[model samples]
Target chain A: MTDPDTDRHNAKMAKKKAARDKIMATKTDEKGLVIVHTGKGKGKSSSAFGMIFRCIAHDMPCAVVQFIKGGMGTGERDLIIKNFSDLCDFHTMGEGFTWETQDKSRDIEMAQAAWAKAKELIADPVNRMVLLDEINIAIRYDYVDVAEVVTFLRDHKPPMTHVVLTGRNAREELIELADLVTEMELVKHPFRSGVKAQAGVEF
Target chain B: MTDPDTDRHNAKMAKKKAARDKIMATKTDEKGLVIVHTGKGKGKSSSAFGMIFRCIAHDMPCAVVQFIKGGMGTGERDLIIKNFSDLCDFHTMGEGFTWETQDKSRDIEMAQAAWAKAKELIADPVNRMVLLDEINIAIRYDYVDVAEVVTFLRDHKPPMTHVVLTGRNAREELIELADLVTEMELVKHPFRSGVKAQAGVEF
Candidate 1:
């Protein structure tokens, strides 16, 4: 008893759904993923943290290693520390941005320490997702060897663990190795107009 | 006495923090923000959801009206429905993608209903953050009038409320009006390689 438009819509949706099912049928592979988020826009790390939140919702274990952003307080870190501490291994190991530190050797040392922790988390099969927050920045600065990182991921990573690397200037090697890579392009930012970062939105 | 490297790092950071503090001092205005997330890459809606999580952490009330993504089960929707129902007003008011539905009149009706709900949320001062999820797509398809949407936002949005719009092909008008805009460019995606969208990652 449906009208012509409703009948037509239903028929069209049925056809589309069938085609989608056929496409879905071919995607049978299940394994870990290497996800990379990079570029000058704001959401690279925020989006990674979003995934961590999603993992938390599903009760999946997660580990986070922040390479160059630990010198100051961030809302996401504080929230994780306060509520989801049991499900998350959160480490903010950096002394701050490289420019702020202004010490190449010290920055390299911190990056190495963070990488050590990242390797440990990746090697452990218990953790479902390991977020290498800002690790790309470290790699971009040559604090961590890109080839070594790739080799470790290929040789040592668990089969079902997801690893997310985020920051600006991600290496070509990492991008090539990643299963998903997103570049957050800066279209417009309030900061350029003298608006400062605010809580509950920026951090 | 600390090591020379440590001392130098501390001095540099002190100077940098001071400069940052100076910049922070000038930022006195606080008001609502119109934020837009657009482009071909993923994480536009995911990043907006991340902010919703942040708001939940801060005990802020939020309202989300999804324009074109409610034909099936999504992990994020389920998670919020299960846990954070008290803090968020969640609405999924679309039949599916435009191609799937293939009915302009029905799509317009759904878009109008969603926009009505969006206006209600945006006008309510109790809602600190109102996310108009995928409204850009609705506007792109001309199911809703862009001018009307912009006028409503400009005239009715509460001063302290934040409104976020997520979807591809954001209108130039919205971009011009937004305080923060991010274009997520796709660098690589596993879907192109036959990897299906898995739960907890894509949803």
Candidate 2:
């Protein structure tokens, strides 16, 4: 026989409980992550930023390492790191993106160190979200070893960590390992029509 | 007869001249301006992030205040803001998106304050970039005064400043004034297909 008081309590819990708690209780959190944002489109990094913004709002520990564009000349990194010093950890490999870098060896080295840093954070289940900006394109150029990256992510700690990889030209192997994957296929671009990259539009 | 050396120089200059440059050169610099992004597709904010990331690399001043998400807790803001603290500004409004806001008065109030902050920064030419993310949607809901925003932009300074607006439902006036505009129209979404919003893909 179903007790009336027990049924009433269950109803209350269903209506008032935190949605996150409900989700966490039902699904086993998968620590494994791989997000490949590829396309001839804009906003690949911005898509990753959306995740970063959301993750931090949730109180999840996170880190960001932009491979090709993490240099001293950028304004976004400066603006972000200065304001939220206590809650976030920001690191740039001090290397610009490949198209801007002429030396292939240096490019590869930057990508390698970036991968290592990402691996270090992933190992610490405390870092829940990791944004690897423009990584797939770097991998495509062999700027870093894709095999090593795949292996590291596959072995990442589960139930407490997540990783977000954003760039164009995502690999099939990486996509296969990703529990969640978003492919941003570009349909149009202003640069194609001869518009220069504005400071806030294309930076 | 014209000098051969002068003729050569004249030819070179003529070859490099652009049809629009003469007019553009005379226009005043855009000290700063706000960009609003909204749409059915993903990556509205990602585009803004690309600019932000690029700005951070350059050591330019920038501030990001994302509304429609907060208090859920995330580490994206926490981690990057740590190392690049001197360069960037990161603030999440923590009140999840407007669709979820359901409170019209609260939404309007949030829009007003956020717009106030963005306008303040944007008016400063030294700020470089001020992305008023999702401003289009806010305007659509009457959360902001669309006419007033257009008037401010119409009287903008150029070159020295730039405003990047990202979002769907860009009003007639906003698009007319935008030096650059991009629309991310949705073809498909994972959320509609029953896949939950992933940490990195859709935070």
Task: Please report how far candidate 2 places residue B135 from its true position, in Å.
Answer: 1.8
> Top model by DockQ, which number?
1
lDDT of 2 by residue, A54-130 (tens): 66556667788877664222444554576543445677873664434444556667888988887777787767777
- TM match of model 2 to true structure: 0.59
Give the C-alpha miss distance for residue B174 in model 1, angstroms: 1.2
Q: Number of clashing pairs, model 1?
A: 0
Per-residue CA lDDT of candidate 1, range B1-203, in tens?
A: 56886777667867887897788788777777899999999789888877777777778899889897842226566667777899989999887887676666778899999999899889989999998889998899788899999999999999889999999999999999999999999989887778876655775
TM-score of chain A of 2: 0.77
Backbone clashes for every candidate come to 0, 69
lDDT of 2 by residue, B1-203 (tens): 55675466445545445434554455544334334444455677665666766666676776665544532224345544764556556655526555344444566788788777767666676666665656676677667888888877776533456566655677877766665555554644334334455554454
Candidate closest to the true structure, highest TM-score? 1
